[model samples]
Target chain A: DTAVSQTPKYLVTQMGNDKSIKCEQNLGHDTMYWYKQDSKKFLKIMFSYNNKELIINETVPNRFSPKSPDKAHLNLHINSLELGDSAVYFCASSDSRTGFGEQYFGPGTRLTVT
Target chain B: QQQVKQSPQSLIVQKGGISIINCAYENTAFDYFPWYQQFPGKGPALLIAIRPDVSEKKEGRFTISFNKSAKQFSLHIMDSQPGDSATYFCAASKGGGSTLGRLYFGRGTQLTVWP
Candidate 1:
C-alpha cells in the first residue's frame, strides 16, 4: 500500500486557471506538508499543517492556499496560476515521534503552466 | 546565507568505487540530520541519517559522518554501482523539545555511477 498518495501525477493548465492537487496519507500521521521543487531541484516548504491547523507558512504567494479537512489529508489550491508557479509539487508526512523526523514523500505531481 | 550548503553539484564514480557528498549547516539548534535519495521524476526517499551525539552512522554500504564542532556532515557510499546513481540531499531539522518541523535541504548532489 502507498503510504502517501497524490492525485493527478501530471497537471497541465493555462494561466489564470484555478487548480487543486489532492494529497492523502494512510500512515495516520498527525502532520502533513506541501513542498515545491523548482526546475533547479531546490525543494522548498510552502506550507505545513499539524492536525488540521496551519502551523508554518513560508513566503509563498497568497494565490496558493492549503486546506486540511482532517488530519489525514492536505490539499493545495492555486488561483490564477502563473507560469512561474509551474513546478513539481510534493506531499509528505511524518509522525512526531519518529525521532529522526523521517518524512515519507508521495510521488510528485508535475504542474505545467502554458 | 544559505542555512545549508552542499558541495560538488555532481559527481561521477566507477562501479565498486566510493562516492561521497558533503554538506554544512550553521544552525546549532539543528540536531537531526538526514540524507535523502531521489530518482528522476520521483520524490526523495530517506537514505540514512545521523545525530550530533554520534560522529558516524552506517547502514549497509551507506554511511553518514558528522562533525559537530565543524558543523559539517557527509554521506559516503561504498562499492558504488550504477543502480546507486541518484540525486542525494542532506537535510537538517531542529530537535530537543521542538516539534516536528520542516527540514532545511541542501541544493543536492547528482551522483552518476558508470559501469
Candidate 2:
C-alpha cells in the first residue's frame, strides 16, 4: 500500500478560482507537511501540522490555507489562484520520535493556473 | 537569506562513473542532513541522510560526506547507472521542533547517466 497519498494529481483552473488538494498518510506519523516545487525545480516548505496542531507556516500568501482535521489528513485550499501559483504540491510525513527522521513524500499534485 | 545552497544545477556522467553533488547551509542549528532523489512526475524520495556527529555515511551505492565544521555536505553516487539518472536535493533541518522536522531544501541538481 502507498504510505502517503494525494488526490487530484492534476488541476487546471482559471484565475481567481478556488481549489483544494487532499493528502492522507498511512504511516501513522504525527507530522505532515506541504511543499511546493516551482518550474525551476526549487522545492520550498509551505506549512506543517503535527498531530492536528499547526506548527510551521512559511511566508505563503493569505489566499493559501492549510486545514488538518486529524493526524492522518492535511488538505491545502487555495483561493483566488494566481498565475504564479502554478506548481507541483507535495505532501510528506515523518515519525517524530526518531532523531534521524526522514520524510516520505507522496506523488505530487500538479496545479496549473491559467 | 537562502538557508541551503547547492551546486551544479545539472550533471552528466557516464555509466560506471561517480557522480557528486555538493551543498552548504547557513544555519548551525541544522543538525540533520538528508538527500532526496526525484524522478519526473513523481515526488522526491529520501535517498540517504547524515547527522553532524558523523563525517560519512554509506548506503549501497550512495554515500554522504559531511563536514560539520564547514557546515557543508555532499552526495556521492558510485557506479552510476543510466537508471540512476534523476534530480537530487540536499536538505537540512533541526529535528527538535514541534513540527518534528521542517526541512529547508536546496535547488535540485539534475543528474543524467549516459549509457
Candidate 3:
C-alpha cells in the first residue's frame, strides 16, 4: 500500500477554471503538508496542517486554500487558475512524535493550466 | 528569497565513482537537515538526514556532511550506480514552534550515473 497517495495523477485545465486535488496518507502521521514544484525543480511549501489544524501558511495567493478533514486527509483547492499555477503539487506527511524531520511524499499531481 | 541554496544543478558520474552535491542555508534556527531523492514521475523520498549536533551522518552508501558553522551541508554518494541516479534535494527545518515540520527545500540537483 502507498504510504501517501494523491488523486488524478495528471490534470489538465484552462485558465479561470477551478480544480481540487485530494491527498491521503496511511502512515499514521500527525502532520501533513502541501508543496509545489516549479518547472525549474524548485520546491516550496504552501501549507501545513497538524492534527487537522492549520499550522503554517506561506505567502501564497488567497485563491489557494487547503482543507484538512482529518489527520489522514488534506485537500487543496485552487480558484481562477492561472498559467503560472501550472506545476506539480506534492502531498507529504510526517510524524511529529518522531521529531526526525523525515517527510514521505506522494507520487505528485501534475496540473496544467492552459 | 530562497532559504536554501544548492550547487551544481546537474551532475554526471561514472559507475563506482563518487557523486557529491552541496547545499547552504541562511536560517540558523534550522536544526534538522534532510536529503531527498526523487526519480522521474515519482515523489521525493528521504535518503538520509542529519542534525546540527553532529557534523556527519552516513547510511549505507549515502553520507551527509553538515557544517553548521558555515551553514552549509553536502551529500556524498559512494560507489555510485545507475540505480542511484535521480534528483537530490537538500532541506532544512526547525524542530518545533509554528514552523514545526515545515521544510525549506533547495533547488534540486539532477544526478545521472552512467554504467
Candidate 4:
C-alpha cells in the first residue's frame, strides 16, 4: 500500500503558466509538507501543515501556494511559474501524535517549466 | 542558511565493503535524526532513525551513529551490495514550536555500489 501518493508524476509546462499538484496520504498523519529538490539534489522545505492548519512557511516565493483541504490532502499551486521553478516537488507526511519525526514521502512530481 | 550539512557528494563502494556518510547540524534543539534512501524515479524512504538520547541505532545492515555534543551523525552501511546504490539523505527535526515536525534535509550523497 502506498502511504503517500502524488498525481501527474511528470509535469511539463511553459513559462508564466499556472500549475497544480495534488497529494494524498493514507497513513493518517496530521502533518503534511511540501519540498522542492533542485537539479543539484538539494532538498528544501517550502510549507508545512498540521491538522489542516498552516504551521511552517519557509523562504519560498509568494507565487507558490500550498493548500490543505483536509488533514489527508495537501495541494500545491504555482502562479506564473518561472524556469527556476523547474524541479522535483515531493509531498510528505508524518504523524504528529507520535512526535518521532519520521516522514513518509510521495513519489514526487517532476515539474519542468520551459 | 543550510541547517543540515552532509559531506561527500558522491561515493562508490564495492560489494562486501562498508559505506559511510556523515552529516552535521547547528541546531542544538534537534533531537531526532533520520536517514532516508532514494532511488531513481522514487521518493526517499526512511532507512533508520536515531534519537539524541541514544548514541547509536542499528537495523540490519544499516546503522546510525549520533553524537549530541558535536551535533554530528553518520550512517554506515555494512556489506553493501549493488542493490544498495542510491541517494542517501540525512535529516534532523526538533520536537516543539512552529518548526515542530519540520525536517531539514541534507544536500544528499549519491552512492554507487559496484558488484
Clashes per candidate, residues 3 or more apart or on different chains: 0, 0, 0, 0
The per-model lDDT (C-alpha) reads: 0.92, 0.92, 0.94, 0.93
- Give the best candidate by lDDT: 3
Chain A only: list TM-scores of all candidates.
0.97, 0.97, 0.98, 0.97
Clashing pairs in 1: none
Candidate 2 is graded, for docking, as medium
The first chain of model 4 has a TM-score of: 0.97
| Model 3 spans with C-alpha error above 4 angstroms | none
Give the CA lDDT, 0 to 100, for residue A86 in model 2: 97
Ranking by DockQ: 4, 3, 2, 1
Interface RMSD of each: 2.0, 1.9, 1.1, 1.1
Question: What tens-digit string does per-residue lDDT give for candidate 2 at B1-115?
Answer: 7789998899999999999999999899888999999999999999999989999999999999999888899999999999999999999988775545788889989999999
Candidate 2 at B51: error in angstroms? 0.9
After superposition, which runs of candidate 1 have C-alpha atoms over 4 Å from their true positions? Answer: B96-100
* Residue pairs of candidate 3 with colliding backbone atoms: none
Per-residue lDDT for A70 in model 4?
A: 96
* Fnat of model 2, as a fraction: 0.59
Please give, for residues A1-114, the per-residue lDDT of candidate 3 as tens digits: 999999989999999999999999999999999999999888888999999999999999999999999999999999999999999999999999997379999999999999
